[model samples]
Target: MDHLIEFWPILKRLIKYAIPWKKKIILAFCLLISGATSEVLGPILISYFINNILSKHKFYFQSTLIIIAIFIILQILAVFFNYFQSIYFNKIAVRVINKLRNDVMNSAIKQPIYQFDSQPIGQIISKVTNDTEVIKELYDTVAPTLFRSITLIIIILFAMFTLEWHMAIIAIFIIPLVIVIMSIYQYYSTPLLRNVRYYLANINNKFNETINGMNVIQQFRQQNRFKKSIQNSSQLHYLARMRILKLDGFLLRPLLSLISALVLCSFIFSFSYFKNEVFEVGILYAFITYLGRLNEPLISITIQQSILQQAIVAGERIFSLIDSKKQEYGRNKKRFKTGKINIKNLSFSYSENQKNILNNINIDIPSKSFVAFVGHTGSGKSTLANLLMGYYPIKHGEIYLDDKPINSISHCVLRKNILIVQQDPIILADTFFSNIALGRKISEDEIWKILKIVNLFSLVKSMPKGLYSILGEEGNTLSVGQKQLLSIARILVKNPKILILDEATANIDSGTEKLIQKTLSFIKKNTTLIVIAHRLSTIVDADLIIVLDKGNIVEFGKHEKLLKIKGCYSKMYNFQLSKY
Candidate 1:
């Protein structure tokens, strides 16, 4: 019952995406009808050849040859129309799949930071890649096949009844019996197929995780353990596939038996009735031919039911992902030119029962001022940064930029003005210049200037292919410090007003850190810079340092002032000095 209910939404969405290609679908259906009619003519033509030309010794070679030629032409035309139909249908299916994939990706990316933190990367990838492919198969294979089967059954049965009433009655009875048997098999086996799909997804998820964490596995010398995990997942997938195969065998045996029985009985009954009649032997041959034709369409429907059921399951999963809530655009707020940020009584928690990650955190950052957040591990420093960027919602209170609630501002405006340079830079496997440009159309001069500002001009000039050098996967060939420099250059090219550095210098060497520090000092006067750092030495020269402990501010003042107080900030400073 639940599965049936789930299917409705998928059906609705399929129709929604398919609306644009309705004309093509209609043409495809027309082509299917023509093909079906051509098939129906084959048996009738055989009956004419057997009864009129061969049996009564009254033969017209010209007319017989013409009929044969016309039938052949119709068959050729049918194949041509089917080919065109497949082309249009596949094109539409690809478009719908692409649209669905894009929508799901956009929604997942826009989800709250907490959602991203809690979800596994592999599960999300499974939804976007494997699940979407299953939906595509539904359109490419199941939908058209099922529709064509219906057309063939209808046209064949109509022709059967016109040729002989008694045999037609037997067919009506036997066909319904086959349908009943198929329906029973479908009802009992759908749940198993659904399980097969889930297991397949689980296997894919496990494979993706193992491949992504291959480096960690090797570093920890846990290759045996990782291999065992993959082996277990593969065995489970094999068992699930075998279960489906078992059900298929069970259904096929009984279906074949039923079809064989029906054919034998029809042949015996037809021979008894026409044994002594003046009818041409060719007519009886054609009748037998038509009987064989009728059985094939019914067999096709029986066999394809399993595929249709699997498709329904796949469609349900895909539609569930598509129907998920989209991230709110927040377009109603008024725009402001100033860069003031106000957090008022803000509280946020990832879950309802958990303690707030940020509790009543109220602060104001004036326009064009450099502010830094200093905290220990698990002190909610990153949470605060995410909130300021509107990556997640605050459960209580609100955040404002220039006195306008941040929630009301459009995402486009926020993203255009605010940018974050993460600790681990995201390097696409692409050319050096393309990675730095990152989809923005910037002039060559602008690119060179940003590269120079980040002190990467010397490196680029020394390379054999300057800006065109290809970076290996995730920029693996680039040194850590070099990747950091490239990240800075990428950000500088964007020219954002609000710049965020979340421990951006943590992975680089001390010399690279000093260079980045000098660059930050140079850019601080122009941009609203918010730096989240654990190393007290990094933010010592900042205009203001806000110290956080357990989601609350323990101290907020100039670095020198906070040190003089000998509080949390002083203790952290003293610890760092001791380490040095």
Candidate 2:
């Protein structure tokens, strides 16, 4: 019982989302009560009119017409209130759901990359799509219907008790029994509903994963494997729904009907056993009417229990996400004057218990200097660049920008000055110019200028609509080289001071590599460039080359000097040249 009462607070919080529409709720409630009251009065008035005025002992024509008119009016009024109740309740449900969905999506957006890396994209999408829909059904289907049924039940009880306590005693006697049944069913079904929500999230995650990797599946001819995985997720969802079906199938309609029939029989037996108890005919008729209708609310509540529980479970997930700590942002707003980077005793890891990906690293990158980091796989080259980009927190290092600690700068300010170009770039589904500018208010000429810098002007000019040509998802219409150049053009348009190229040429052909190298050479004179390269030949003229081995810088100098040192850089340089 205590645990059941605990759900009240969660429910109240869900209701808080509806507070903005309090007026509509208030009016809807009033209308519901009015409709219920009018509905219950019908049986009472019919019994009264039949016994007092329409009886053979007292035939009154005008009064009969008046009573009939009043009955019709009450039924008509009930219809009116019922119609508007649905209208306002629907409006409230839609608007409240709209607000909640927007908040969940916005929260997901503000969350840090670690959150996304930890949780699957499909699960997050399920929260925004599936969970919100559950809450909507709660308010739209379960809530309003439950409210009206409960109101009518209350009115019927009051009418029965007012007529005769004897019959009312029987009605109230079955209440505790029904409560126990519903409570037991709810207790078992809540966790099942929770599991249903869980399985749904998994199914969505699997669907998203399969769709996103469809090309890989097809290429490897592993469609059967992916198909089975999807089927398994969907099967788990089906099994969970089956448990709910068992619960509702047993408790909702069949049990309520049985209980209502039992009550009706008990009333009939009580009246029959007390034959000389002087039960009034009119009051007896009313008792039968109330007894026949007593279980409607109970039935409705039992059936909608699954919906209520689903909403509650879904609410838990949705609110858990919304209430999660957002990505940390500093208050400092200082912008970088120069792109110089200084690291003192820097050591970093993706996680605390994990080994440091960059261990005790120290380096100085002067502004407007061309620098390159060359290392074999697991050598921490990309990790160092990411740390410089502020993607991860510095655990054992103090990084300085110009002269101040890097943490002293706000994220917005820091990101405004730095940009990272990776082997795989995000290409939004939009026009060429929009993809390049990306919310920057630069003109067409400026876009063309940056494109020319990246050597993509001719490519865009050859397109059907030039800058206005819509790119497919992931810019699929463009070759890998063209996509990469388009991404670089975007960076040039932003004109950030510090640029990190993290294996940007790893996937492109030699011709594209030369094209990108030319663009790099053109831009190296003005910006701080840190290139993490596998192709050592391209960076032979870098102002400085830092060679990392197992998270430590083993060699640092210009290419010719590093060759003389015959260290890690020398071996890596030799290996690449031999491959060529």
User: Best candidate per lDDT, number?
Assistant: 2
Q: Quote model 1's TM-score.
A: 0.92
TM-score of 2: 0.94
lDDT of 2 by residue, 429-477 (tens): 8999999888989999999889888888888899899999999988889
Tens digits of per-residue lDDT, candidate 1, 1-580, equal: 6655765666676668777788888987787777777777777777777667766777898988988998898789878877876776788789888988898887787665666576667667777887778777667666777677788777777876676666556666666677777867677767887777777777777777788789898899988997888788778878877887877787755665667577657756666777546334554565566656666666667777777677677766665555665556588545457667788998888778999887788898987788899888889888888887888766699998767787788887887767788888889999889999888899888888888888889988888998888899999978888888888787787566678888887777889988888778766766788899866788887778899999998899998899899999899889989997
Model 1 gets an lDDT of 0.77
lDDT of each: 0.77, 0.85
Quote the lDDT for 311 in model 1: 64
State every prediction's TM-score relative to the real structure: 0.92, 0.94
> Which clashing pairs does model 1 show?
50-282, 51-282, 51-283
